[model samples]
Target chain A: MSTRLLRLLAPALLGTLMVTAWYGVHLWLDTEMRFLLPTPVQILGAFRDNGESLGRAALNTAEGALLGFGGAALVGFLFAVVLSLSSLVRASLYPYLMILQMTPIIIIAPILVLWVGAGLKSVAIITFLICFFPLVVNTTQGLISTDRNLVELFAMWRTGRWQQLVHLRIPSALPYFFTGLRIAATLAPIGALVGDYTAGNSDGNGGGLGFQAIIYSSQAKYPALFATAAVTCALGFIFTGAVVALSWLALHRWHDSYERADR
Target chain B: MAVPPIVELREVTKRFGDGPLVLDRLSLAAQPGEFISLIGPSGCGKSTLLRLIAGLSPVTAGTLRVDGVTPDAAAAELAFVFQEPTLLPWLTVGRNIELAPRLRGISAMDRAATRQRVLDLVRLGNRADAYPRQLSGGQKMRVSLARALALEPKILLLDEPFGALDEMTREHLNEELLAIHAEAKWTGFFVTHSVAEAVFLSTRIVVMAANPGRIHSVIAVDLPRERTNATRASRAYLDLVADVSQLLRSVESTAA
Candidate 1:
């Protein structure tokens, strides 16, 4: 591997090594009394045995995350447009958005589950609630931050509000909206996982990864639980990385932040 | 031959929010095809006076007219250039120039023709696709000038358009400005601080004093119609610059 690639991989490799060392201690502890932590080798074996089932569960979780994220993006963008266009709407609705943003996702997840019932709807609602705020806030700020002089220039020419919004405000808001989307994407997987835990079992029998975590903890299946967790963390990383790549591609044409910094 | 003044300001006074008055009872008029420059210190409200004429800001008290009508009524006949390059950073240079006529309900084909003509006039014909970021400061200012000219207004109000440029660039643009005015014959009221710049480009220079901006004197430049680099070295041009410099010095001393 190139030195640069190695440099990027070093931290992850070190973290894996430390985790393995910790797992060894857990195995030693399990031999004595507690079965809390599991050996890395045993966990990997459990992962291999359960790979097919876990992969299916991962797909289910990914579907919920994708649906929720896409839906929230559309809604948040519309809200941002409304916020920029109508000061009265912003004045009336901004505080409510702030409330939605600050409310704990863990607390909201159970309530969403109760209202929407089990399965995809509940999970999607939870993910959307978690992901919507940043998109709205960033997009609103971007739209509002247009150059006053340029705005006046358009006004002098008698450009209508709708035309200005279409040609100016929205294009200006793209980089900011994508920034929000990238952040939301990272949080999306966690939102779906939490929703699954709160909303109870899928098909009234199969515990998704999150409920499997709860069940494994109850049953003292430490290796299986640890394996499930490793997969969940991997899922989160994959989602977040995809968002970063997407954001980089989207804004690389205009914004400097996406450009790779020279030494 | 007997056309009236294109724009007239009758007893125009302007004050900011709860602040002191900026322009006090300023009365000025621009004859059709006349080029006038308003020169003063930084806080002399020359820009405010320009904005008054452009109808960007309402006069606090007294009549502000353009093309013998109120600015609101004469909207089609007035164009303004701000001190800064106010080109839309997001739009291409050609689109920025096309904005005014497009907003005025002109057809796209006509707007495109006008845009091309104005860009050619400003000598920015090749930079139509470039964004504002890709432009040099001088080029950006040129784009802004093109945008104003694209409106093809009878009266142009410029608020120190080349104030931000270096001395060489400023001098160069001053020559280009004179050439444009000569060809188009639009009535112009340009605001600036440089004495030589005002004398070189203007038919008449209106010198103002600070702290309640009012005209101190109006010096009519008697230089020849053809102002080349050689004109800057002419005795007549230098004498006019000296006279305006003396007026500015007197204003500064009186204020001090």
Candidate 2:
């Protein structure tokens, strides 16, 4: 087969095999135990019945994820800039930042709920905390690891610290920044869902997929639970896909990773 | 009365944080429009000398002056090119060329004009919109050269700028560089390993010795000022290259 055909066919083939295995397990299970594993058909039926609510939940989670991701990107970039300014500053503060990253979000979620009260605010903060570390780490590494010769070239012109950061360091750091963004992209939705699960409002109108998961699992709606999971997975893919598109838009013309082999 | 040297070094010494000396009491001077090549074995501090003159690093001791001022103070009058092209990959050829002027807060119109002039000087006028990655190795180096020239510097310090290029491209760039130098008349301090390159480009070659690097000899080239491909094959140029190579070999052996 042609490469393009193989590329498309390979994934479809794997998916067909996976669905067949899943259906076989579903059929082999005792009817009393079937609730533990909804067949693909049952999950599809759940999607048809709860499509509108699932869509709303997906949107709510997306809003929270995007807001948190934006806040993390802005604050993380500024923090990295500050850290990149001086070795003394970086040495003193980097450990504290590491400590923040090391402290699990589960341990901090309740404190966030108490401080912010359970709602979108807590959800956003939780998401921010989850996505912030990689952005700061990657951007700082990029900022510091600027090409030595380029730095000297800038220094030769008596380039001020600010100009050097803006012109040389930041541009050079972009590929790295995108790498972090992609990582954060994969995590953002998960963060939002976790936040919503722990601290979100229980209203039917605004409850995210995480809240929906709670409702479906409590009611023992196995098929609906499976559908919620598929939706969450799709949301994660959407976030990553957006980031990949943005990266291509920013870098495809110049970056080596994005350059076409044929070209 | 004599014209003052544009760059003067007196008993200059440098070392890195108690490390062994990289350049020891090294002193040299360049008249207003001299092209000086520094050639020596690896680790002889040819590059370090260029960095000191460019104000990228401070001298550990002694005095070095450019245009009657410290290198730091004279930074606006200087530019440097590295062995690698060092062109910002994110920027187009034109934007890379305009980088210094833009940072210096030159108005947009002037930046555009200066970019055009330098791009044309490097014979990359049509490639202004191309990114550094889109260009060949030689083209990237040309952009780097253009970027340095955009500064309109009075002193250009290049540390083995063409060392990574193939011989054919290296020779091509060397000819283009001399052409630009002839017109711009900047005081050039070039560090290189190629004897023929040194002879072809420099009015004076400073051969250095390693192990506490110091200038071992300075040879003046009596070839015509305006050089071309023919000059590379000329009897005088060939003889100078041979003589400099022999001097360099002797320096390396003794230093070893």
Candidate 3:
């Protein structure tokens, strides 16, 4: 088979096998408590029935994720640039940044709710916090890891620091920056969902997949909960896919240079 | 009467950190339109000396000048080509050539002409839109040469620019380089390990030795001015190549 056909066949076969197994398990255990773990078909039914409500929640969650991701990209890239300027700055600031990364976002979201008050604002902050670190670390590595000969070429051109940053450092950092962005894209949604769960309303009042999932769990609506969870995963997949596409478009030519260097 | 040297080096020295000197008390002068090559064995600071002239590295001692000015000032008049073609992969052939002027903040209106001019000079005029990866090894090196020439620099400093290319490509580029230099009239400073290459390209070859690398000898190339593939087969070319080879063999023995 051709690569393109194998690519489609492998994933389709896997998904089919997984869903069949799930349905078979649901069929074998036919108890009144079977409603607790909804099967694939019931989840799909629940989504069809509550499509409007779920779509709203998913949209809200997506908005918060996108906002937080954009903020992280800008702030993280600037932070990496500033951090890379000197070893002294990196030494002084890096440990504290790493400490923040060590702290879990779920734990921090409640504190953020107290400070920023629970809403999309706090959710975005939580998402930004979770997503920022990878961008910082990866982008800094990329900026500093430019080719030595290219750096010397810049010197020969008598280029100013700003020019060096624009032409050399920025382009060199692009593939790594995109790598960081890809990480942040998937994590942003998770952060937003966790933020919604920790700080959102107890009822299905707040606008997010996490809030809806929390409400479904509380009310014993297993099908809606499973459906929302599946949709959230899909959202994450879509966000990551978009980022991957962006990276390909931007760096396909020169990005291969980094790969070649690695080999 | 002596035409003033475009580049003058006197007692120049370089050492990394507190370690022993890599280059010691080197003195040389490059007159206008001179294609001077620094030839030596591996690890003789040949590239380092090239960098010092390019002002990418500071000299440890003594004076180095381009047109009676500092290295930093000298840089404005020179373009450097590395052993690896070093074309920015992100850029097309045209954009790579345009980079020097772009870095210097030349306007697009002014640079369009110069960028086109150099691309044509290197015979990459048609390949301007092609990315670095889209080209062959020779084509990429041609782009590199075009990039340097695009700046319209007074001197072109080459650090074994064809060191990575195949022998045929190397010879082809050497011929192209001579043709371009003949028309452009810029001084050239090339560093290489091959004696044949040195003789083929240089107006004068400054043979070097390792262990605090310093100039061992300088041989003036007396081949005919207008050279072609036929020139490479001539008796004078072969004899000159032999003379440089003998000098390098002596340096290698001493280094060993």
Candidate 4:
């Protein structure tokens, strides 16, 4: 098959095989145990029956993720810029940043709830914490590794440090920044889900996918739980796909990563 | 003596952070409109010398003056073209050419005029909106040259700016550079490894030796001011190229 055709057909082929295997397992299971391991059809039926609530939950989670991702990007970039200003500042603060990253989100989530009083704010804060480190580290690396020749060229012009940062270092860091965003995109939904489970509003109107997962599992609604998982997976894919699209839009004109070798 | 030397290096010594000497007591001077080429072996510090003259680096000892002042003080009066085009990838050709002026707080109107003028000089008049990545290697180098020329500096320091290009492209750029230089009347310091290139572009060739990096010989190219492709084919140009090649070979052998 042509590569383009294969790219489109390969995932669909795997999904078909997976559903067949799942059905085989469904047949093999004891009648009493069948409810615990719902088949793909059962999950699809559950999605149809509870589409309204599922959609609301997905939208709520997306809001938290988007807000958190935005906060991480803005604050992380500023932090990296401040760190790039001097080695002393980077050395003094970097270890603390590492410690923050090392501390598990689970351990911090409840504490975040205690501080922020359990709502979208706490969920967003939790997601922001999860996404912040990579953005800062990658941006700092990019800013620091700007082309030395270009820096010298700027120096030749006697450009101020501020000018150097604005014109040269920041533009150079953009590819690296996008790389960080792509990484964070994959994590944003997961962080939002975790935050929701720990500190989200449990009201029917505003509860996210994480709350749905908890309610469905506790109520032994195995098919609904599976549907919730599928929605969360779709949400993650949407975030990653959106980042990839944004990166292509911003960088395809100039960056080497987007250049076609055959062309 | 009506116009003093545009650049003067008196016993200029440079070493990097207690390391071995990169350039040792190198003394030279260039008149206001002279084009000087520094040709030597790999470790001869020609690029370093250019950097020092451009005020990108400080000499560890001795004195180097540009436009009769310390290089730092004369910063606005000089521009450098690095070996790589070094154009900011995110910027369009016009924006790249306008970088120095923009940094120096030149008004948008003046910057646009300067950008157009330099782009025209380098024959990239229509590539203003194109990004550096969209350009060919030679075109990118032209943009780089245009960017330096945008400063309209009295002194131009080029560190083997055409070294990465193919021979054909290099020759084409050399001609364009000379034409621009003739019009601008800037004192030029061009660092190159090609003897033919050195002979073609410079009024005087300073051959350098590698160990401790000092000048070995300075040969004056007594060619016509208006050089062209015909100038390259002339017997005088060929002989000058051969002479400079022999001098370069001697320096390389001594360095080895």
Q: Candidate 4: misplaced stretches above 4 Å?
A: A204-206
What docking grade applies to model 2?
high
Model 2 TM-score, 2 decimals: 0.96
Per-residue lDDT for B154-249 in model 2, tens only?
Answer: 999999999899999999999999999999999999999999999999999999999999999999999989898999879998888889989999
Clashing pairs in 1: none
lDDT of 4 by residue, B1-256 (tens): 7888999999999999979999999999899999999989999999899988988889998899898899999988998888899998888899888878987889999999999999999888999999988899999999999998898899989988998999999999999999998898999999998999999999999999987999888999999988999998999999989888887888788777
Tell me the tens digit of each residue's lDDT in model 3 across A1-263.
69999999999999999989887777777688688668877888999988988998988888888889999999999999998888899999999998999998778877888897887888788888889999999999999998987887787787789888999999988989998999999898998888777775533345788888877788888899889888889889999999988898898765564346543
Which of the numbered candidates is closest to the native, going by highest DockQ?
A: 4
TM-scores for every candidate against the unseen true structure: 0.89, 0.96, 0.95, 0.96
Flag the better candidate by lDDT, 1 or 2. 2
lDDT of 1 by residue, A1-263 (tens): 69999998999999999988886677678466645665677788888977776777777777778888988899999989999977888999999999988998778777776787778788888889888998899899989988787777666665678888987788778888988888888888888788777774664346467666667678777788878778778888988798778777766644546445651
**Global lDDT of each candidate:** 0.82, 0.91, 0.87, 0.90
DockQ preference between candidates 2 and 3, better one: 2
For candidate 4, give the lDDT of residue A128. Answer: 95
Sort by lDDT, top down from the best:
2, 4, 3, 1
Q: Per-candidate DockQ versus the true complex? A: 0.39, 0.84, 0.67, 0.84
Residue-level lDDT tens digits of model 4 in A62-98: 9999999999999999999999998999999999999
Question: How close is each model in CA RMSD to the real structure?
Answer: 3.2, 1.7, 2.5, 1.7
